[model samples]
Target: MKIKYAIIGAGPTGLGAARRLNELGEKSFIVLEKNSYAGGLASSFTDEKGFTWDIGGHVVFSHYEYYDNLLVEILVDEYLEHQRESWVKSGKVWVPYPFQNNIRYLPNQKKWECVRGLLPGERSEEEPANFFEWIINTFGKGIADHFMLPYNFKVWATYPEMMSFSWIGERVSVIDLKTVIKNILLERDQLSWGPNNTFRFPLKGGTGSIYRNLAETLSNHILYNTSVVSVDQKNKIITDSLGNTFEYEFLLSTAPLDILVTKWLEKSPETLINAADMLKHNGVIVVGIGISTSKKDSRCWMYFPDDNSPFYRVTNFHNYSPNNTPVPGQGRALMCEVSYSEHKFVDQNKVVDDVEEGLVTTAMIDDEDRKNIISRWSINVNYGYPIPCLQRDEALKILQPALESMDIYSRGRFGGWKYEVSNMDHSVMQGVEWAERMITGQPETTYRIS
Candidate 1:
């Protein structure tokens, strides 16, 4: 089959691209998704017991007006708005969401150390080499040692020293010395921080509902269960696992760049292969536990930096929407995220038990609560967070333009290899922008080849 545009992966990016193409009255394009359904990693699943769980704790917040309008248009009034009620579980205390600003809740000695280390007097004209140095230089040794270092290690799996700090834009809350001291002195709660301070979520279906509904509009153009195995770039033809061949004038690949360059391409250069090797990511094991208790606390999610929990973050899934649980008032859901990489390995067989045990140890759930477990669900995603290593830019520098030269546009979370611009909205916008660029000769803004 011949098409003007062959879009790979029916995730947000592919869906966004298709949506935009439909808007532009373009009809010669088709989207190929390997999965039976759309939404990619942003999808959701329901357990046998009627408890719904997202792939991870996904919250819907956008940076673009177009994205916001699109979702509102798709979901209509089926979305619920929420104020972020996040916290960090440190020892036995619940520090406010920005752990740095609420160090007063920490023990006296630790608090003193954090304050003592806060006075900024540095003379480093040169940029910090890695995330470790960046943390120590930015937040000092106390905060770094107490929450930043260990928590980051658990979340990233890769060592902070080995990763780059450029992706830390808005993702990490840097300390404001005056605000920290003021909040500590007045004992104020500083939780209103970050762009996701207020967000929206689907009222009935899990987070996947938004994307699934969006895809429903362009269902005819989507080819599900069609996995592309190889691409003959020279001939502008692609072959799927089922031996079906497609000829395309342009290809927008939302697949991982490494897999595309290494496995899909007929031939790859040694340098390109080495560059692809430099790309690093952590796998996520999301364990969804449903309980038979209605929670009174309105906290949305909590971060676990300590060793008491095998998971890095846990979300009160039911709090996102009332319909997340089957029994509503009688059911509650806890979605836990455990990140694993080569540097930090996890025994998949025992991860569920570990998560439950850790929850008990951390006081998230009690022994009595364990017996109330009604349903359990878990999904292991191989490509979770794209680690921003020091070598990432150098590698992308070599990979992106080379692939683009051959009419291949890799845009998405893992496809772009940019954690800075890898949020749901960003990924979709990347795809939309890619489509606009291909269709109208517009210069791409959200994703840059450079």
Candidate 2:
């Protein structure tokens, strides 16, 4: 008897799994997407003026060759490779990224404080119990106290002490003392240190184009506007929102683990319930501002670590592609700003006003620049960045095996609930590898930290 499979969620992970199944001649599958379209959090939308904006902001950085190979196969001729130019805005200083390494730009007293914190001392035999301790140990107290602690609070919407350090492998950069001193002495900007030194973006049609291409490949098997409302693991049946039921031999769920356990499992475990309650996520408010300036050259994305700006980051969406906004002769530049918070009941009008005020305060736009404002729109995503809080690992440890026991594999950014491997490339490869594992019982590289 042939094995039948049913995939829940039409995001990158589910699509990847479907692609892999197709390649292996396994046609016994159906993709159920809740939304009217594909690409979960990574989807795109166009405003009334034809400007393209992503859900928040997404960039593709891959560590796996298979991921790259598959993208090349699908995207074919529709991708643009870009070098990353990122910076942190602290106070009035435009410090280079890995702000700790560029402390020479700081005051002498602060510099000395950092050095004092780094003096070789009695190392703790025990491991760091929280994110704050881990950062202090890795970058010293100066960097952590000055930037890491405060900036992270703004971004993650949680206190550092409340977060765990187990997710800090390649996600956070660990500065080398020798290199730091050398760069500071030489007054050099260490631009080539991290995983995102060079990356790719879709040349046209925005980041969603990649997903659109993936969906095009499996157009026949994908079922849009079909939301999975419940699942009966014991009976191997999934009921859609429209009251249609489908049976399968295997299940791949990319939905939130909390919802799956609460609604699908036979006897939801108390441990899983507790884990769900512990899981905390930050919401994102993405504001797209279209201006009427001829300044063709602007930084790709700027980091706002200062209090003046409510947004944590801003991407010059037009810089990615001319098509991302109106044409140069026809219109002006476009900027997309992202703000994160844990609360869901934030007033939309208030957020818009705050964002506009922040843009002017940060000097991204002038006070009298209303003439340049051609269009403005906003999108709010409830699950933006997965907070690596102290309880995250405990939740995953208990929830992952429970889902697996029901023959359901959940993978992707929100699916696995991992921010470390939640980039476009990582999420897509997660889907690919999950399929390979299910087909051949192979180990998944994305799940392995080393």
Candidate 3:
């Protein structure tokens, strides 16, 4: 097949690109998706027991007006809006989300330790050298020791020293000691912090429903169950696993950048080969535990920094949408996430059993409530988050330009290799912006090649 544009992967990015191409009345384009379904990392599945599970914790919140307006047009009233209710469980104490801002709930001894580290003379005055140093510099040693360090390590599954803190932008809450102390003195809660403080979820299907619906609108232009194994950039040809080929003027790849450079390219250069090596990432195992009517917990999700939980984060899925359970509002769906990488290892076969035990150990569920467990569903994804190591920007600078020179563009979570702009909205906008740039003379905003 030959086309003006060839989009790989039907996740938010590809779907957004294809959808925009259709909107712009561009006819010569095709979307190739490896999965039987759309949504990629944002996809979901319903088990035999009828519990729906998203690949990871995904909430609908937007930073762009275009994305906000897009969701309104797509989902209409088919979603639920909720104030973000998130918490962190540490030292057997439940602190509100942004653990640093709500240290008042900590035990007195530990609470004072957190405050002492934030004192004027306590924090290091040096500019942070890495993510670990940034944590210490911003939150002080007390908060770092008690929450930030361990919690971040658990989530990233990569050592902080190996990461760059440039991506924290709005993902983290940088609070002043005065705010922390004032909240403690007044016993107040600071729950709102990030862009997701107010978010939405599909009323019935899991988070994937939005993308799945978008894919449906572009079905005629999509080739499902197809995987591209090689790209002859010199000749502008793409070859899939079945040996089928596509000739294109421009190609958009939403696959992992490392794989694209090292594996898919016909002749990868030594420079590109070394650059791909610097790109690091972790895997994620989302374990979904659905039970019969456990005591209600209003918090949307909770973070676990201690060994009490084998998972780093757990979401109250049923609270997001009762349809996540077999019968609406009849039970609880606890979606647990555990990240793994070279720096961290998790035994997959025993993880579910370990998660169940961790749930009890962390007091997320009562010891006797195991009998109410009705369903267990899990998905293991190899390319979870793109770790923002010190070499990321340098690597992207090299990889992106080389591919663009060959009329190929890679953008998405792993495609762009940027965790900061890898959210659903950002991924979609990357695609939308890319499509506009291609069809018109407009310059892209979301994923730039600079």
Candidate 4:
């Protein structure tokens, strides 16, 4: 088959591009997805007990107006607006989210340590060499030791010193010494800090419903269960697993950059191959446990920084929407994210048991409540997180432009290899922007490596 454009992967990015192309009345493009359904990593599944769970804790919030507008158009009235109620578990105490802002909840001695480190004369003039140095330089030793260092290490599955600080943009909350001091003195809580403070979710179907609806609008253009096996970049030809071939002028790939370069490309440059190997990532095991009743009292999510829990984050999935659980008020669920990599290995077969033990150890579930768990479901995703390591930018610098020159526009979470722009909104906009650049000669602005 011959086409003007071929989009690989039917996730948000691919769907976004295809949706925009349909809106523009362009009909020369085809989307090929390996999975039977769309949404890629953003998809949801239901357990035997009828509780719905997302791949991870996926909340709908956007930094771009276009992405917001697109959701409004697709989901229509089938979405829920929610105020973020998040917390952090420090031993037995529950500190409100943004642990730095709510240090008043800490013990007297701990509070003094945090506040004393925040006092003047700790700021450094030299630049930070990595995320660890950056955190200490920006937040001082107390906050870093208390929350930032441990929590980041758990989430990233890599040492903070081994990762780069460039991707920390708005993903992490930078400290405000004055505001923190005022909050501590006033014994007040500061809950609003990140972009997801107020977000939305699908009221009926799980997070995947938004993308499924969007895909439904362009269903005829997408080819499901078709995996691209090889890419003849020189001739602009793609061969799928079923012995089918497609010829295209422009290619938009949402596959992982390393996989695309190493597995699919017929012949890759030595530097690009080495760069692909340098890219590091962590896997995630999302374990959802559905209980007969609610777990916490209206809290949306909680962060686990200490080793009390093997999981780094636990979200109250039932709070996202009533339909997420089997019954409205009587049924509830807990969704926990446990990350694993070379640095931190996990036993896949025993992960569910580990999560259960972690919950009891962290006091998330009591002995009586543990017996009330109606169903248990776990999914181990290989590409759970794209780590922003010290060598990531250098690798992307060598990989991206080389592929772009060959008519390959690789953009998305793993496709672009940029965690800062890897949110659902940013991933979709990257696709839309790529399509706009191809069809209208517009300059791409989303995935620039600096």
The candidate maximizing lDDT is: 3
List the global CA lDDT of all models: 0.90, 0.77, 0.91, 0.90
> In candidate 3, which residue ranges exceed 4 Å CA deviation?
none
Expressed as tens digits, the lDDT of each residue in 227-259 for candidate 4 is 999999999999999999999999999999999
RMSD of 4: 1.2
Q: For model 2, how does the per-residue alpha-carbon lDDT over 1-450 read when each residue is reduced to its tens digit?
A: 123888888888889889988987888898989888888888888787778888766787788887788889878877778887777776767776767777767667776776666667722335788988887887777777777887787778777888888777777777756766777689887666578877788877788888888898998888899888778788888888889888888888888767787776666778788887777788778888777565644467777766777787878777777777766344544454554565324566677778777888877777666567877888887777788888888788888887788887778887788888887778777888888887788889886422
Candidate achieving the largest TM-score: 3
Off by over 4 Å in 2: 1-3, 107-113, 120-126, 264-267, 296-298, 328-346, 448-450
Lowest summed-lDDT stretch of 10 residues in model 1? 117-126
Itemize residue pairs with steric clashes in candidate 4: none
Error of 3 at 282 (Å): 0.2
| Ranking 3 against 4 by lDDT, winner | 3
Tell me the TM-score of model 4: 0.98
Total backbone collisions, model 1: 0
Report how far residue 23 has shifted in candidate 4, in Å.
Answer: 1.2
After superposing candidate 4 on the true structure, give the runs of residues whose Cα lies further than 4 Å from its correct spot: none
What's the lDDT of the predicted structure labeled candidate 1?
A: 0.90
Clash pairs detected, candidate 3: none
**Per-residue lDDT of model 3, residues 246-280, tens digit only:** 99999999999999999999988989989999999
| For every candidate, C-alpha RMSD to the true structure in Å | 1.2, 2.7, 0.9, 1.2
Q: What is the clash count for each candidate, in the order shown? A: 0, 0, 0, 0
**Candidate 1 TM-score, true structure as reference:** 0.98
| Predicted structure 2: lDDT | 0.77
